[model samples]
Target: MLFDRRAPYDFFSVYHVPDVVTQRQFEAGIAASGWYDYFEQVNISGAALSPVGALLNNVALLPPTPQGPQIPPVSPITKQRVNVLGRTMTYADEGAGVPVVFVHGDVMSSFLWRNVIPHLDGQRTRSLAGDSDKLPDAGPGTYAFATHARYFDAWMEALDLRDGVVLVGHDGGANVTFDWAMRHEDQVRGLAFSEAITPPFDWEDWPAQMRPQFQYLRTAEGERDVLENNFFVNAAPQSITRMLTPAEFTEIVRPYAQPGEDRRPTTDWPREVPFDNDRSQTRTALEAQAAWLADTSIPRLHLPGVPGGIARLGGRKRRLISTWPSLIEAPVPGLHWTPEDAPHAMGSALAEWLRSLIN
Candidate 1:
């Protein structure tokens, strides 16, 4: 029998098929059912095992584990603090090899990469995810993208990470990554972005429904929403695929719990968005970044979530791929917060791309 006729519950719960079943029977049954080949291909391609591969590997009846190469047990993530730009910066540094620096976007800290970091090849890459200075409790400073980029530089200098660094960014983090990379192009080995803010950010490009919301964010009413009502923190659940458990939601909003100027980073980041023909420093930096992204020879990767949040509003993906010479597109299924929803897919694609850079 393909599955244990005696224990149907075991098959459903633990994916356990008794060893008494012949390998051929199991393989035949797996082949008869589609998706086996898809997982096999994902494994063969050197990406981390998908959810189905995890299930197949649990079966004692299968010989020669089908889930590609074995992944080492992920080490527990430990938070470390370092003084950067005269302020204490929190970051998670684990594994060892070529450095892959992960920069998170607005309203998120290094915590965002908790699931994604382990998917990287621990043997071949060192993962560094830093909480920017703008985040609550990270110390006071101007929360502009340029200031954040400078802090990124200082943090790297403090760590002595001068060269051969791969930058991975999301949302506001992506903008910081682009700004930092543009200034220190020689130090960056590769770039990866998900739900990022790229160039040609015209007001007309924004979706009609989102325009009013963004416009509101640029006003005093938006400040009240963020500071007093905790709008962004409360609305975060709507951006992702799954509901955040009570503990999860609490942990995410913990930093911003206190009211007052501590929440300025959350508010200021939205206003920094370059809409229309604005002549702000943010716009100037992005204009310069656009030119660099177009001409740079460094390998670039763009992982767009299917029907992504921000990048999906306009023809952002199409424009980015067309403009960037070395850009590689890898689409994962999710919404805005891909790391929260499609962690495995996002991490696998990131790992595969990072591997390509080194080999």
Candidate 2:
């Protein structure tokens, strides 16, 4: 259940399961390919990270590595599908601790967290020189966010994981996390939202002073042009995009453009919307989610950053600020949006916030 930037068609969704016409059992596959030496690395996290001011916290944890032939069957890289509402949601897990699920944001799969997982795990080893001890890079506790939209809520319960859990959500994912937290607050120890999102129709219109700074709502030609003029045209980095090699540009844009296919939709959406091309409905849905979580009164952690330009105008002004009052501002107001933008001014402030959590 690892995340990859593959097309939704490449992803096997629960709605349409591929028939096991001639399936090779896991055992059979293992027997045939005895040369199993490269499973993914796992991390075991051991410290609490302060939510304030770090672009990325250097977490102390073990990392997961792909399995080798000599590794036993129950090695860290092993993952299996458990039944959830009669559907099989595959998950990859490692180590043992309070379960924390890693959720991905829009245009990203759980793959984004692959690097962060290693930074927080809690296992270690001592150097033969007896100089110091350090955690190995096997991985942290089992963290997975590998299901499509509908099954996520149910799957969380089926896993019967730790009683209290911490969840991390970014961008579009904040929508899902917000809904789930409201429904299952007892299960969530902490909630985190990055670049908070809400449906366009759901947000309070920008104050008139800020209206010209943003243009949204495109259900019609007039509104569409408004979004195109203020949103897409300004949002899409045509200049930077054209500079990329054809392959590079295509790989990045294609997923959002065609999705499952030019006509096929994926990830719970009914139709494959060429949002990269359409750029419609996205803001609408985002605004709705944003409205719902507009003031998350719960204790939470928020880390927000993205490519500069359009996102800030179209999204940052309304979404980020509207979404995290309860969690972010209330907890840490002193950190800057971009540490690089004001590093010197925010150095002690950010470090103090992060070091507090790490300790």
Candidate 3:
């Protein structure tokens, strides 16, 4: 069997080489071609000789199958646009059945969910991920949580999605989702969060190593970094465990390549983060969402990661899991950008939780 160590596979494929001579020739050819390190050969006989069945009996000798849902390659999603609050918003509307809207946080667009949305059961669920009005590609708008939440409401209205909608948010998007859910509880069916920044926590709760960067982002120097040098776009790699490929990095920073006032959303978002029990509007909205999250009976899912960025710290994650009565926790392997680092596991957990809400 030919196996690519990097590919995601739920099962092993067994190829029947008719004879030992051919097998030796194949091995020799692979070794001669200098690709021997990438290929492995396993021999099976007797009861395992069901070549037609395409099943291996001696599984112990084979490489372990990947756990969790197998993630597919990122594909091009047809971009759809709609006018929401006088701004043209870009979104990806795919699949059918129950509606699940995905909201991205700062420095990212709906493209963040490109790999994730594919894992959902398309026939049973409709996946919708949109770039918020504040995003560079989505046109300009106010960057406050309340304003973003209002824009979300208008986006929903423009799309004619009023009921039975599952709202999933990451980072700042979580705050907006929470705000929208609080005001229109009747319209939302469930909620899911990853690296969410709701339920305002103390500044000390942030990762000690990352505190300096976050603090800097809230300063004048940071504003220059964001507007002139595309700091947030370049710093995205720090939030995730894996290094993004050149292609991926290029695609992510393409919208914010030029230096100008247009990068205001990136700068404004960092400043909006509350610290030391501040009385800012962002803090107020977060605190109110925290209260609603504690009291609401709406089904919720928390897709936290190990050593996650921001809100996924040990105490914060524990509080979220313990305090929220109706929340389900599905921990994945990643840092801050769980969606980027563990899309298969994150998507599978989210799909399962979403299915439960519908059933």
Candidate 4:
């Protein structure tokens, strides 16, 4: 996995040096630190380790500018707004032929698929993103899977989308898409997912390095950290292969840059993670969907990223592909955010996979 759970190696030796320390002196101190020694012992020499090594070097040297290519701007496309099930939804509806529906996960909107959508060529595609309606006001039933599946199903139904509609989902959207497919498989033509979460796994199963992050988010302190610092917008960019351009960074962070109910989605998304199993609606719904994906005969595509993609932290046995005989695994290069990191590669893979399904 190119971006596995990074060890919490404290590279704080440079910080301890006097404020007047020269760059060369700082480098000398860092090189002699135990943290640097530990990383030096690890064999980080390959395409898989390049990004990791770069990140480490960046931390050690504190470069004034990024040393890698910057993420390109999202493709140009006009966004349209429409009311779906009483909520105003933003989307891009274009092209013609088979319908391709793109569903985005938390901390992001449909803009996530901007680059990939244009590369889809002749196919008609619509990305339903931006502010979503609050999960139905139905008591404690406001869980992610059931709530999102209900809203998504209604949105598709409103659009009159039925048989032969291609479905593509990312991150949390994967869970929502899987749930929708389980209940409405007959309507879907093909399903493609990347960075999806499937279980028999939970917070405990997360890598030691990442477990703390997940666990902290379950607390009020974590919510404050996210809101005050715009954690998703700031931290997520690091997962990409290139640095985000100033404009691109601004666009991605715009949705959550403010301190209001607008940031609620980012805060709520993590807490709702089905890290613990209970008869809760989220858990029950995810459990059912996980089983369905394993056994479903529907045409499916699994776009795993370089080094492991979403399945990185989780081992092979715990991955959805372990039991999904019908899924076609196409390994592409990128971290969790494949669209930003490897848009061309992702687009080609998606277009090729869809064509194969038709053939």
Best by TM-score: 3
Q: What are the lDDT figures for the candidates, one per model? A: 0.72, 0.37, 0.73, 0.66
| lDDT pick, better of 2 and 4 | 4
Question: For residues 233-275, what per-residue lDDT tens digits would candidate 1 score against the true structure?
Answer: 6766666654454655676787678876667777777788887
**Whole-model alpha-carbon lDDT for candidate 3:** 0.73
Candidate 4 stretches greater than 4 Å from native: 1-71, 123-143, 207-209, 276-279, 317-320
- Model 1: how far is 220 from its true place, Å? 1.2
What lDDT, from 0 to 1, does candidate 2 have? 0.37
Q: What is the C-alpha lDDT profile of model 4 across 183-281, one tens digit per residue?
A: 788888889988787775655544444466667777878767776776655667656665565677677877777764556667665666676554566
Clashing pairs in 3: none
Q: RMSDs, each prediction?
A: 9.4, 19.5, 10.1, 10.6
Measured against the true structure, the TM-scores of the candidates, in listed sequence, are 0.76, 0.43, 0.78, 0.75
Candidate 2 residue spans exceeding 4 A from truth:
1-78, 123-149, 199-296, 306-323, 329-359
Better TM-score candidate (1, 4): 1
| lDDT for each residue of candidate 2 in 1-359, tens digit (9 for 90 to 100) | 97574443432312211222212243346456753364432222211113322222223121322221121111133345667656455565544565556555433333334333433345221000000011123122111122333456766767764356656564445556766776666766666544444333322332232233233322334233422233322222231211223433343344345312221111222121112234444444444445655554555665544222212334534345645555542221111122222212222332233333334
lDDT of 3 by residue, 159-276 (tens): 9888888899998998788888888899889999988785546777776656777799877888788888998778777666544556666777766777866677776777788888
Q: For each of the candidates, give the backbone clash count.
A: 0, 49, 0, 2
Error of 3 at 105 (Å): 0.4
